[model samples]
Target: MNKENREVVRPDGTTIHYTVTGPADGPVMALVHGWGCDRRDFDAITGFLPRHLRVLAVDLAEHGDSRSTRDVWTMEEFARDVAAVLEAESVGSCVVIGHSLGGAVAVETGRLLPGVVTRIVALDALHYLSLFPAQDECAADALLHPFREDFAGAMRGMVEAGSPPGTDPALVDAYIEKMSAVRQPAGLSALEGLVSWDMDAALRETTQPIVVFAVRAIITQEAIDRYGDRVRIETIELGSHHFHVESPEATAALLAAEMSA
Candidate 1:
C-alpha cells in the first residue's frame, strides 16, 4: 500500500493537504476529518481498507499540514478545499466519509459536487440533537458564547460531552489537549463556523444518501426520529465520539462495506 502525500492550492490561496492511497482507477473514497483534527486520523483506517479502493484523506484548511489565511470559515468554504483536491486528482466519482464537523463538510461537498459524489458516510456524526438541527442566529451565538470566551474550557467540555460512559479520563484529556492546541484564531473560528452552519439547509439541498454510524450511548432518540427518513442511522458501540480512531479496523470495514454497497 503505497501512499502519496499531495497538496492543492485553493482559489482563496489556502493550501489543502491530502494523502492518496490504493490504485489510481479504483472507486474513490474521500475521508474528511472532524474539527480540531487532520487527515492523519485516517491513517489506521486506510491501512485496513482494501487495496483496490482509492482513498483520499484530506486535511481541511488550517488543520493538520494545510495552511490558510482566508477569513471565511464556512463549512461550504471547507468543502471547496476538498473539492479542490478532487478536481486536482480528477476523481470522477467518490463516496465521501466524514466525522463530526467533517460530516457537515461532507454534506456540503456532496452539494458542491453532486455529479461526482455517490454517497455520504458519517462516523458518529449528524445525530446530535442540539448541534445538528437548525438554530436561530441568536441561539447559535449563545451556544458559541462559552467557546468564544474560554476556548480551552470549551475544548475540554467538547471532549467530555462526546465521551460515553466508561470512557477513559486520559483519553478525554488527550483529545482535549490536542484539540485545544489547534492553530489559534482559526481553531476558534472553525468552531464558530461549525456551530453556525445550517445543517438543515445543507441536508435539504444535498440529496445524497447519508449513512450515519452513531455511537449508541451519545445519540439521542430525537435525532434519529427527526432525520431518520433523510439519513440512515446505524447505532454501534464503538468507544466515544472519535470511535474511528479507537476502532479503526471496524470503522474501515464499515466504510468498505458501504462503498461496496
Candidate 2:
C-alpha cells in the first residue's frame, strides 16, 4: 500500500494535512492522532493494515503539518477538521479511531456526522477521569495551574502517567520531549478544551458503538464501571497508553479486526 500526503482546506480556512493509503473505494478507516502528536504516528500502523482497507491518517489543526488561523480549540472544531478531510475525499462512511485526545475528537466526529461514522474506537482515551467529563472550574483551574507554571514539566507528567512499569526509560524520555514541543497557545488551549469537554453530554448524543482499547496497566476499574455500559471497554495488555506506536503490528491487527467487527 502506498501512502499519499494530501491537504484539504476547510471553509473556515483551516488546512488539514493527512495521508491516504490503499484503494479509495475500499472500506474506510480514519485514524486520528492524540493530542501533542501528529498523523505520522500512524504511519507504521497503516503499513500493516489490510490492503483492501482505505486508511486516512489525519493531522489535526496545528498538531502536524495542518495549519489553522481560527482561535477555537474545542474538540468539535477539531472534528470539523477531520470532517473537512473526509468531505474532501467524499468518504461515505468510516470507522473513526482516535488515541488519547483524538478519542474525544472521534466522539465529536461521530456526533458531527452521525450517519457517516459507523463506529468509534478509542485507544487509551475517554477512560481517564482526570481529563474527561468536563471538570468543575476549581478542578479545571487546579489542572491548568501545573501546565501554566511549567508546560514542559506538565507535559512530562502527562507522558509519564501514560507509561507503565517496565517501559523503556529512553522511550518515556522521547515521548516527553516530543509532546513537550507542541506549539504554544494552541497546545494550552487544546488542553483547556479537553479539560472542559463534556464527555457525558457527548456520549448522550453520540449513538455509534464505541470500542475502547485501554491499557490494562493504567486503566482504573472506576473508569470501566463508569463507561462499560456505554462503550465496549477492552483491557489490552499493550505497552502503555501509547501502545499503538509501541506495538504497531499488534495494534494494526486489532484495528483491522475491529473494522471487520
Candidate 3:
C-alpha cells in the first residue's frame, strides 16, 4: 500500500505522527492503536480493508513516532491529538476506530468531534477496565502500584490475563516485551489517565453509535448487559487481546461490514 507519512502539531505543542493511505476524497476511517502500541499495528489491518477507504493510522503523543511536551495525559488530551490530525487533514467526517486504550480515546474523540466523527469502533476495547465503573481511590492506587513498582512484571501479568486457553506462548512473550518498552512517564501517565477515565459519563455525552468487538473468552455478561442499551457488544473467538493484530483480514472484514451498514 502506498502511504504518506505525516505530522501534525496540536495546540499543546504535541507533535503527532501518522500514516495515510487511499484517496483523499475517499470515505474516511481513522485507526488508533492500543496502549504501548503504535500505528504500525494496523498496517496489516489496513491492507485488508476496502481499497477505496482512506485510512489514517495515528501515533499518539509519546507513543510511536509522536512526541509531546504536555503534562496532561488524559484520554481527552489524546483525543485532542487525534482531533488535531483530523483537523490538519481537513476531514469533515469519519469513523474512528481504536484498539484497547485507543478505544477509550475513540469514545472521547467522538465526544470531542461529535460533528466530525460519525461512529466509534472498539477492537478488544471498552469491555473491561474502560467500561467498568470508575475505580475508587484505593482501588486505583492498588492497580497503579504494580506498574509503578515493576512495569515489566506487571506488563507480563496483564498480557497473560488478556489471553485465553490456547493462545501461543511466543505471542504472549512478544506482547510483554513490546509493552514493557513503552516510554517511561508517558506510558505510566497514560495508564493513569485510563484508570481515572469515566466511560459512563463520556457515553452520556456522546451521541455517536459505539460498537465493541471484544474477545468472547474475556468479556463478561455484566459488561454486555450494563451498556447494551448504549453501545453494541459483539463477541468474537478471534485469538486474544491483540486479536486485530493476529487476525487482520477477518478484523478488516468486520470493520468493513460495519462501515457499509
Name the best candidate (by lDDT). 2
TM-score of structure candidate 3:
0.97
Clashing pairs in 3: none
Model 1 / residue 123 / CA error / Å: 1.0
Clashing residue pair totals per candidate (backbone < 3 A): 0, 0, 0
Per-residue lDDT of model 3, residues 1-261, tens digit only: 689999997766689999999998988999999999999999999999988899999999999999988899999999998998999999999999999999999999999998999999999888895324577788889988999999999999999999999999999999999999999799999998898899889999999999999999999888888888889999999899999988999999999987877
Q: Which lDDT tens digits does candidate 2 get at residues 1-261?
A: 778999998755688999999998899999999999999899889989999999999999999898887889999999999999899999999999999999999999999999999999999999999899999999999999999999999889989988899888888998898889998789999999999999999999999999999999999999999999999999998797889989999999999999999
Local distance difference test, each candidate? 0.91, 0.94, 0.91
Q: Which lDDT value does model 1 have at 104?
A: 89
Candidate 1 per-residue lDDT over residues 1-261, each given as its tens digit = 999999998766699999999999999999999999999999999999999999999999999999998999988899999999999999999999999989989999999999999999998888886666666788778778888889899889989999988887888888998899899778878777887778888898997899999999998888888889889999999799999998999999999999999
Candidates 1 and 2 compared: the better one by lDDT is: 2
Candidate 1 lowest-lDDT run of ten: 128-137
Candidate 3: residue 225 Cα off by (Å): 1.8
Off by over 4 Å in 2: 11-13
Better of 2 and 3 by lDDT: 2
Ranking by TM-score: 2, 3, 1
Best of the candidates, TM-score: 2
In order of appearance, the predictions have TM-scores of: 0.97, 0.98, 0.97
